[model samples]
Target: MKGFRFGSTQGAFYILPGHGGWEATYGNETLGEFSSPQQAADEVARGLTCPHLSEVDTSTLEIPEKLSDWEIVHV
Candidate 1:
Protein backbone atom coordinates (compact mmCIF):
# COMPACT_ATOMS: atom_id res chain seq x y z
CA MET A 1 0.00 0.00 0.00
CA LYS A 2 2.65 2.50 -0.99
CA GLY A 3 1.57 5.94 -2.21
CA PHE A 4 3.17 8.10 -4.89
CA ARG A 5 1.91 11.29 -6.51
CA PHE A 6 2.52 12.07 -10.16
CA GLY A 7 0.97 13.48 -13.31
CA SER A 8 -0.77 11.48 -16.01
CA THR A 9 0.81 10.62 -19.32
CA GLN A 10 -1.95 12.34 -21.27
CA GLY A 11 -3.53 14.83 -18.89
CA ALA A 12 -4.47 14.75 -15.20
CA PHE A 13 -2.16 14.13 -12.27
CA TYR A 14 -2.85 11.55 -9.59
CA ILE A 15 -1.67 9.93 -6.42
CA LEU A 16 -1.45 6.20 -6.84
CA PRO A 17 0.07 3.07 -5.39
CA GLY A 18 3.76 2.50 -5.91
CA HIS A 19 3.43 -1.26 -6.28
CA GLY A 20 2.04 -3.04 -9.30
CA GLY A 21 -0.79 -4.71 -7.55
CA TRP A 22 -4.11 -4.20 -5.84
CA GLU A 23 -4.84 -0.65 -4.69
CA ALA A 24 -7.53 0.30 -2.21
CA THR A 25 -9.08 3.65 -1.47
CA TYR A 26 -11.32 5.08 1.18
CA GLY A 27 -15.11 5.66 0.91
CA ASN A 28 -15.59 2.97 -1.73
CA GLU A 29 -13.52 4.85 -4.25
CA THR A 30 -12.29 2.75 -7.17
CA LEU A 31 -8.67 3.62 -7.92
CA GLY A 32 -6.91 2.21 -10.94
CA GLU A 33 -4.36 -0.62 -11.18
CA PHE A 34 -0.88 -0.74 -12.67
CA SER A 35 1.45 -3.38 -14.04
CA SER A 36 4.26 -2.30 -11.76
CA PRO A 37 5.21 0.25 -9.18
CA GLN A 38 7.56 2.02 -11.57
CA GLN A 39 4.87 2.11 -14.21
CA ALA A 40 2.50 3.72 -11.79
CA ALA A 41 5.13 6.20 -10.69
CA ASP A 42 5.99 6.97 -14.27
CA GLU A 43 2.35 7.66 -15.05
CA VAL A 44 2.23 10.08 -12.18
CA ALA A 45 5.39 11.80 -13.31
CA ARG A 46 4.22 12.08 -16.88
CA GLY A 47 1.24 14.33 -16.24
CA LEU A 48 2.71 16.50 -13.53
CA THR A 49 5.65 18.86 -13.73
CA CYS A 50 5.54 19.56 -10.05
CA PRO A 51 8.85 19.85 -8.24
CA HIS A 52 7.13 18.23 -5.29
CA LEU A 53 7.49 14.96 -7.10
CA SER A 54 11.20 15.24 -6.59
CA GLU A 55 11.25 17.11 -3.29
CA VAL A 56 8.24 15.91 -1.32
CA ASP A 57 8.84 13.29 1.38
CA THR A 58 6.59 10.28 0.82
CA SER A 59 7.84 8.21 3.74
CA THR A 60 5.29 9.48 6.22
CA LEU A 61 2.22 7.91 4.62
CA GLU A 62 0.76 5.10 6.70
CA ILE A 63 -0.18 1.90 4.95
CA PRO A 64 -3.56 0.43 5.60
CA GLU A 65 -3.78 -2.71 7.72
CA LYS A 66 -6.23 -4.28 5.29
CA LEU A 67 -7.85 -3.63 1.95
CA SER A 68 -10.65 -1.12 1.96
CA ASP A 69 -14.10 -2.55 2.61
CA TRP A 70 -15.54 -0.27 -0.09
CA GLU A 71 -16.13 -1.49 -3.61
CA ILE A 72 -13.05 -1.44 -5.82
CA VAL A 73 -13.26 -1.14 -9.58
CA HIS A 74 -10.33 -1.68 -11.93
CA VAL A 75 -8.86 1.33 -13.61
Candidate 2:
Protein backbone atom coordinates (compact mmCIF):
# COMPACT_ATOMS: atom_id res chain seq x y z
CA MET A 1 0.00 0.00 0.00
CA LYS A 2 0.98 3.61 -0.54
CA GLY A 3 1.04 6.40 2.06
CA PHE A 4 0.76 10.15 2.53
CA ARG A 5 2.38 12.69 4.84
CA PHE A 6 0.55 15.60 6.44
CA GLY A 7 0.92 18.36 9.02
CA SER A 8 4.00 20.51 9.79
CA THR A 9 7.61 20.23 10.94
CA GLN A 10 6.82 20.05 14.64
CA GLY A 11 5.11 16.77 13.86
CA ALA A 12 4.21 15.50 10.42
CA PHE A 13 1.37 13.04 9.75
CA TYR A 14 1.87 9.68 8.10
CA ILE A 15 -0.56 7.17 6.65
CA LEU A 16 0.73 3.67 6.11
CA PRO A 17 -0.34 0.03 6.25
CA GLY A 18 -1.53 -1.72 9.36
CA HIS A 19 -2.67 -5.24 10.20
CA GLY A 20 -6.18 -4.66 8.91
CA GLY A 21 -5.61 -1.83 6.46
CA TRP A 22 -3.76 1.50 6.79
CA GLU A 23 -1.97 3.16 9.70
CA ALA A 24 -1.24 6.74 10.72
CA THR A 25 2.04 7.76 12.28
CA TYR A 26 3.04 11.08 13.75
CA GLY A 27 6.59 12.16 14.33
CA ASN A 28 8.33 8.86 14.99
CA GLU A 29 5.43 6.93 16.51
CA THR A 30 2.26 5.40 15.14
CA LEU A 31 -1.11 6.80 16.18
CA GLY A 32 -3.37 4.13 14.67
CA GLU A 33 -4.25 2.13 11.57
CA PHE A 34 -7.55 1.65 9.83
CA SER A 35 -9.29 -0.04 6.89
CA SER A 36 -9.46 2.98 4.61
CA PRO A 37 -8.04 6.46 4.00
CA GLN A 38 -11.20 8.08 5.34
CA GLN A 39 -10.95 5.99 8.47
CA ALA A 40 -7.32 6.89 8.94
CA ALA A 41 -8.06 10.56 8.39
CA ASP A 42 -10.87 10.43 10.89
CA GLU A 43 -8.57 8.86 13.45
CA VAL A 44 -5.98 11.60 13.00
CA ALA A 45 -8.57 14.32 13.05
CA ARG A 46 -9.95 13.06 16.31
CA GLY A 47 -6.76 11.97 18.03
CA LEU A 48 -3.85 14.26 17.10
CA THR A 49 -2.94 16.87 19.74
CA CYS A 50 0.03 18.50 18.08
CA PRO A 51 0.73 22.04 19.18
CA HIS A 52 2.12 23.35 15.87
CA LEU A 53 -0.67 21.95 13.79
CA SER A 54 -2.47 24.65 11.86
CA GLU A 55 -3.57 22.43 9.01
CA VAL A 56 -2.86 18.95 7.74
CA ASP A 57 -1.04 18.66 4.45
CA THR A 58 -1.60 15.51 2.46
CA SER A 59 0.40 14.14 -0.49
CA THR A 60 -0.21 10.81 -2.10
CA LEU A 61 2.72 8.49 -2.63
CA GLU A 62 3.24 7.03 -6.09
CA ILE A 63 1.68 3.61 -5.98
CA PRO A 64 0.80 1.29 -8.82
CA GLU A 65 -2.89 1.32 -9.65
CA LYS A 66 -2.96 -2.47 -9.71
CA LEU A 67 -1.88 -2.61 -6.10
CA SER A 68 -3.98 0.24 -4.82
CA ASP A 69 -6.51 -1.94 -3.07
CA TRP A 70 -4.05 -4.39 -1.56
CA GLU A 71 -3.94 -4.58 2.20
CA ILE A 72 -0.67 -3.55 3.81
CA VAL A 73 0.38 -5.58 6.80
CA HIS A 74 2.76 -4.02 9.30
CA VAL A 75 5.94 -5.99 9.64
Top lDDT: which candidate number?
2
- The residue-by-residue lDDT of candidate 2 on 1-75, one tens digit each, is 466655443545667767778777766666666787667766565555433344433223222222233344434
lDDT of 1 at 63: 24
Clashing residue pairs in candidate 2 (N, C-alpha, C atoms within 3 angstroms): none
Clashing pairs in 1: 6-44, 7-44, 7-47, 7-48, 8-47
Worst 10 residues of 2 by lDDT: 58-67
> Which ranges of candidate 2 are over 4 A from the true structure?
49-75
Per-residue accuracy of model 1 over 1-75 as CA lDDT, tens digit each: 444333223222333453547332222333445665454444333332234334332222232222231123334
Candidate 2 whole-model C-alpha lDDT, 0 to 1? 0.54
Residue 51 displacement in candidate 1 (angstroms): 20
